[model samples]
Every structure is written in C-alpha cells, then in structure tokens.
Target chain A: EAGVAQSPRYKIIEKRQSVAFWCNPISGHATLYWYQQILGQGPKLLIQFQNNGVVDDSQLPKDRFSAERLKGVDSTLKIQPAKLEDSAVYLCASSLGGVRGTSNYGYTFGSGTRLTVV
Target chain B: AQSVSQHNHHVILSEAASLELGCNYSYGGTVNLFWYVQYPGQHLQLLLKYFSGDPLVKGIKGFEAEFIKSKFSFNLRKPSVQWSDTAEYFCAVKAYNTDKLIFGTGTRLQVFP
Candidate 1:
C-alpha cells in the first residue's frame, strides 16, 4: 500500500506571489488534511476533508488560502499573495475515516512540500 | 479550545538508555491521544495511541505511552533507546468522536551511539 504523496517537494516565491501545492491520499482513505509547519513549530491544521466535502477549515486563512478535494480523491491547496510568514512546510495526510475500528487509526502523511517566500 | 503540550523541546540520551517524553493536553471532554515520530527527512509516523480502556497503549517500534486522565497527561516511554530512535516526536490530541487533531510543539530526541 502506497502512502500519501505530494508534489513539487520544494518551492520558492516572492511575497504577494501565488503558490499551490498538491496532495494524493491513500487509495481507500476518506479523510484528508493539510497542515502548515512553520520552522521550529509543530504542524498546524489548515484544512480537512472527508471525501469531497470539507470537514473543517476554521484555521485556514480564508483571506489568502483555499483548498479543494474534487471527486473525493486528490486535493490541492493554494496560497495567494503569500506572506513572509507563509514560508513553511505544507504536509498532507489521509486516514480511513469513520470506520468503527479505524477512525482512531492515525493518519499517514506525505513527505511534505517546503515553501519559501522571499 | 483543545490544545496539546510537550514540555521538552529537546532531549539527548545514549544508546540503551531509558527514554521518557512528556505530553499534556487541555480538553474538557473525552479525547484520544497519539505520539508520532519523524526521523530526519521523513514523514511523521504513528508511534502509539490511546483511545479507551487500558490507559497504557503499545505501538510500533517498541514504543508505548501511558494516559493518565487525572493529570491530563500522555507521556511516551521507551525502556531502552537506540540510535535509530533519533527523531522528532510530537504528541497529538483529538476530541472523542471528532477527526480534528491538536498537536504539541514537538520534542527533538537525539540518541547517541
């Protein structure tokens, strides 16, 4: 079984520029998530999706960030007009959600995309 | 709001030494807990978890954690450490019946050979 996969392992952009990151979750997983990990800090949830619908995105910076999981499969997260603070690692994870015995099973994460804003 | 806490920012130990890392959480309702490890340049992987029943839960790679409801603590412990165990460890918490996870700041463990 393959783990979650992410694209463009690294990216660099100027402030105010737009950047997008992609994620492909495990084949049968129903729950997908995106997190932002700033340097020296832990990963913070930016958004979550259950199938094709969003489960939660309260922490997402709506003013500059957006994400979508289309057809209940792969998903994409975009950050426009990036800020210097947006320079951080973006990680994607997936889990077999809501299954009586599997809901508590932890997520499998991607290698993550490291983004830098100058 | 639910939140997780890891008291140690970094820990260094020699191979074959006992290891313990602290984790605490602030949540009013029933919750689930987990410990995840990320080796250098690798993705975060589950080390252990506690859902219900037994307070002590064992996980992959010979790691285990004890959940103490009274103290609101879930601390990771390894009887003996190895160089292979050098990694960053994070404690995460999720409300029971919810999918969202709150994570700790993480503790970097360096096991010296």
Candidate 2:
C-alpha cells in the first residue's frame, strides 16, 4: 500500500504572507490528522478528520490556521497571514479509524512539508 | 489535560552499548502507548505500541519498550544498539475515548560506531 502523500516538500514565505499545504491520505483510510512539529518540540495535533467530517480541531489556531478534508480523501491546511511561529514541519497522517482488536489503527505519516518564515 | 513527557532530550552512545529512553504520561484513564522513530530526513515511523496484553512490547529493528502502568511510563530499550540506531524517538499517548495522540518532546540519540 502507498503511504500518505504531501506536496511541496519545502516552502518559504515572509511573515504575514499566506501558504497552503496539501495532503492525500492512504486509500481506504477513514481517519486523517494534521500535526505541526516545531524545532526542539514534539509534533502537536492541529486537526483531525473522520472521513469528511471534523472530529477535532481544538488545538488549531482558527484565527490563522484553517483545514479541510474534502470528499474524505484529500486535505488542505491553509495559514493566512502567517507568523514567524508558524515556521515548522506540517505532517499529515492517516489511519483506519480507532477500531479495537485490530492492527489497522496505527497511523501512517507523510514526509511532511517543512515551512520557513522569513 | 493529557500530556506526554520524555525526560531525555539527547543521548550519545557507542556501538553495542545498551540503550534506554524514558517516557512518561499524565493520564488517569485507559490509554494507548506508542513509540515512534524518525530517521534523518525521514517520516515518523512506528517503533512499538502497547495497547494491551503484554507490558513488554517488541518492535522493528530490535527495539523494545516496557509499559509500566503503576509508573505511568513506557520506557524504550535496546540491549545492543548500532550506529544505525541514531535517530529521534518520540513517545505518544492516546486516551481510550479520544483519537487525539499527545506526543512528548523527542529524544535525539547519536550512536557512534
């Protein structure tokens, strides 16, 4: 099976600029997640989608960050008026839902988009 | 709020040396534990997971982790590590009712051959 796919392996933008990252989850996966990993820090969950509907977005900075998983397959995360603190690796992952007693619940991650703010 | 902690920020070791990385989580409910490894310029990969059954779970590349419920810890270990084992390891926890995975700050390991 193919792994999760993300576009624009790297990106650079000035502060207050806008940027968007795209992700395509593994086929048949029903759950998708977006995480931001800062330097010297662990990855933090930004948003989660169960199929096309959002399951969680409590950590997402709605004022600047917005994400959507349309058609329950591809996802897009947009950061408008990006700030210096937004420079980090944006990772996308997929799973087969949280089904117990099964080995399909673990997530498969993408290479991630490394964003740099100038 | 649930959180994960990795006390070791960095570690250096010579080849064939035993390795241990500490990970602890603060959660009072049923949870799932996992260890993930990220090689240089690579995506995060699952090292091991402890959902239930045995407390000692073995993973790929000869890595293993012991889940101690009483201590709220899942420490990763390897009897003998190689230079190829150099990478960043992250510990994550997910509560039984939530799909969110709380991750700990990664521990970077540099193994010299």
Candidate 3:
C-alpha cells in the first residue's frame, strides 16, 4: 500500500511570513491528522479531521495555524505570520477509521515537512 | 486531559546488549498504546500496539512491549539489539472515546557495533 504523502520536504520562511504544507493520505483512510514536532519534543496534535469535517482542533493555535481536509482525502496546513518558534517538522498522518475503531488500524505518518522560520 | 511520559531521553548500548525503554501514560480509562520508531532519515513507523488481550505484545524486528495496566505503562524491550536498531522511539496513547493520539517526548537510542 502506498504510504501517506507530503510535499515540499523542506521550507524556509521569514518571521511573519506565510507557509503551507500539503498531505495526501493513504487510499481509503477516513481520518487525517496534523501534528507539530518541535526539536527535543514529542509530536503534538494540531488538528484532526474525520472525512471533511473537523473532529478536533483544541490544541491548534487558531491565530497562526490552520488546517483543512477538503473532500476528505487530502489535507493542507497553513501557518500565517509565522514566528521563529514555529520552526519544526509538520507531520501528517491518517488512519483507516475515525475515533471509534482507529486503534485497530493504527496510523500511518508521512515523512513530514520541515519548516525553518528565519 | 491525557499525557505520555518517556523517562529515558537518550540511551547508548552496544550490539548484543539488552534494551528497555519506558513509556507511561496518564489516562484513567480504557486506552490504546503504541510504540513507533523512526530510523535515521526515515519516517515514523509502528513498532507495536496494544489494544487488548495479552499484556505482552511482540512487534517486528524482535521488539516487544509489555502493557502493565496497573502501572499505566507500556515499555518496549528487546533481548538483543543490533546497531541497526538505533533510532528515536516514541510512545503514544489514545483514550477509548477520543480521537486524539498524544505522544511523549521520544527516546533516542544509539547502538554501537
């Protein structure tokens, strides 16, 4: 099976600039997730989408970070007015199901997009 | 709120040595636990997962994890590790009723041949 796919393996932007990352989940997966992994830290959930509707975004910094999974297959995460602290690896993951039976299928994560804010 | 803890930030071992990485989660409910490993220049991949039955679960590459519900822990273990086992391991947890999968700060393991 094809793994989750992410674009622009690396990106560099100045502070206050805007950047976006794209992701294509595995075929037929219904749940998509976006996570930010800072240096020396675990990957933190930024947002989650069940199909095209959002299931959770409680941890997302709405002011700067936003993500959308349109048509329930591909997702895009955008960071506007990027801050120096926003430099990190943005990871995209997808599971075969939603909240209920997701654990059974587990998640497949992409290689991730490394962003560097200068 | 739920969280995961990996007490070992880094570990160094020689080939043929035993390996153990601690993982603990704080969620007082039915939960799912997982271990993911990322080799150098590679994407994160599942090492193992525990949903139910058999507290001891074995994964690929001779890796296994014991899920101790009483201790709120699922620690990865390997009887003998190879230099190829060097990588960062992450522990994650998801509550039964939630869609969020929280991860703990990864533990970097470096095995020397």
Per-model fnat list: 0.59, 0.68, 0.77
Residue A45, candidate 3: Cα error in Å is 0.3
Best by DockQ: 3
- Look at candidate 1 and give me any clashing residue pairs: none
Q: What is the TM-score of chain A alone in each candidate?
A: 0.96, 0.94, 0.96
Give the lowest summed-lDDT range of ten residues in model 2 chain A.
Answer: A98-107
The TM-score obtained by model 3 is 0.98
On lDDT, the stronger of 1 and 3 is 1
- Which whole-number lDDT from 0 to 100 does residue A50 have in model 1? 91
lDDT of 1: 0.93
Candidate 1 local Cα displacement, residue B89, angstroms: 0.1
Give me the iRMSD of candidate 1, please. Answer: 2.3
Tens digit of per-residue lDDT, candidate 3, span A3-110: 999998999999999999999999999889999999889899999899999988988999988888889999999999899999999999998775565547679999
A1-118 in candidate 1: lDDT tens per residue?
A: 9999999899999999999999999998999999999987899999989999998999999999999999999999999989999999999999988643347778899999999999
lDDT of each residue in B1-113, candidate 1, tens digit only: 99999999999999999999999999989998999999999889989888899999999989999999999999999999999999999999988868888899999999999
In angstroms, give how far residue A113 of model 2 lies from its true place: 0.1
